[model samples]
Target: MSKPGKLIQELNRMVNEQFATPEFHHFLTLPLNRDRARFFVTQSAHYIKNRRDSWGYVQGAAPLDVKAIIWKHEEDELVNDPRCNSDHYTLTVKTGESLGLKREEIDGSEPFPAGRAAFYAWLHLAKDRPWLEAFAASAILERRNNGKIVRGGSLSDRIGKKWVAELGFKWDEMPDMKIHRDADEAHSDLMEMIFNRHVKSASDEDAALRGARESLEIDRAFRGALADAMEKIS
Candidate 1:
């Protein structure tokens, strides 16, 4: 029976390994030509929308205090933020415009099969698992995006930099990713607080780790599917 702090540290290390997975690296480093960029940005919108669905399940299953925390988190994601002036989905479409994508194109885009499977997996955990396990599963995604947790930088921060350096887009032009770079740090901390308060037993810790690890595996598959899609774009 490890302490909660040690349990969280182990979870963090496990989730960080997702970034080092070959599939994740392959997707992140994929060349961002116009076609690929359009595909990426469009699929990103699908991913963001899936987050809304999955989080709704988590919010429903969570304890009242944790639900309150998630509600505030959703205020920024589902509603307007001071930094973005719109919800995250709209912000993603706005970012796509900088890549020469129209609102219609992004709105009409469908998620690849692997991405859909990943979303369903997340929703299953959020809706069917115990509250702590479900919450940890959902929160681990944001935690993995916390550059402070990950050694180099978060997924959003790293990808945002790549867009700036390789795709010739300015940071300001990609408001969604830019905001996530900062926002997920706080989001991750909030989740940790939940874990500290709730995860008291060895079984609870094991459940949390199981949910987080499974989600990361789905994440890798989703990223790999995206990379394969990008390669096929002509």
Candidate 2:
């Protein structure tokens, strides 16, 4: 009835699982008062920093066309996307100041060592794997975040809700995150299309599926580690 994908069936199964859990949403919804919110925002900075590093390395190994796509993606991330006047990382740090995070506080000592290692390990996979697989790994993270794909709710929606209920900040108060909340949906969709379109053969599909699976597995650990650290943060 339809074209069979080398990996889409399995990849879709794995991708759906990422959303089927309340774990990610729980991390955001857990009642963190102002002091905890302060820590949560600070910790979020560290996680975004790791995201930048992994994405940069993934772009480094992507095919020319996919690289161009990611380059545009990074324009919002590392460079200016015109959508945002500055990089998202800078936008995030500035957003951090709202919750009382100074640059030094964010950059200051005390990050989760295990989380840090996992970030580097993701980069290694992006750098070492074939272009499709590498790109698939990075793409799945956003796919996991995309509300349209993963179900339950997006990471951004959950985070935004928690902020509203806890901190009393309107959506306009954190403009950058609000934009990413929507834009990442398009990004993840574009990436999944790439995976689907290019898998002309079984092996290509297998590689892409492998990349998606491995990335999702690592992400579960990474999120768990971050949640643990946030829970323990004094």
Q: Write the per-residue lDDT of candidate 1 for residues 1-234, one digit (tens) a residue.
A: 447888878978976788889998898888777778888898899888888888889899888998899999999898887666788888899899988889999998888888788888888888899888888888889999998899889999988888888878898899888999988998889877888889888898889888888888888888998899899997
- Candidate number with greatest lDDT: 1
lDDT of 1 at 134: 82
Instruction: Estimate, for each residue in 141-180, the C-alpha lDDT of model 2 and write its tens digit.
Output: 7876777755566777777777888779787766557767
- How far does residue 164 in candidate 2 sit from its true spot (Å)? 0.8
Write down the lDDT that model 1 would get.
0.86
Q: What is the Cα-based lDDT of residue 5 in candidate 2?
A: 51
Backbone clashes in model 1: 0
**lDDT for 103 (candidate 2):** 76
Quote the RMSD, in angstroms, for model 2.
2.5
Question: Which parts of model 1 are misplaced by more than 4 Å?
Answer: none
Best by TM-score: 1
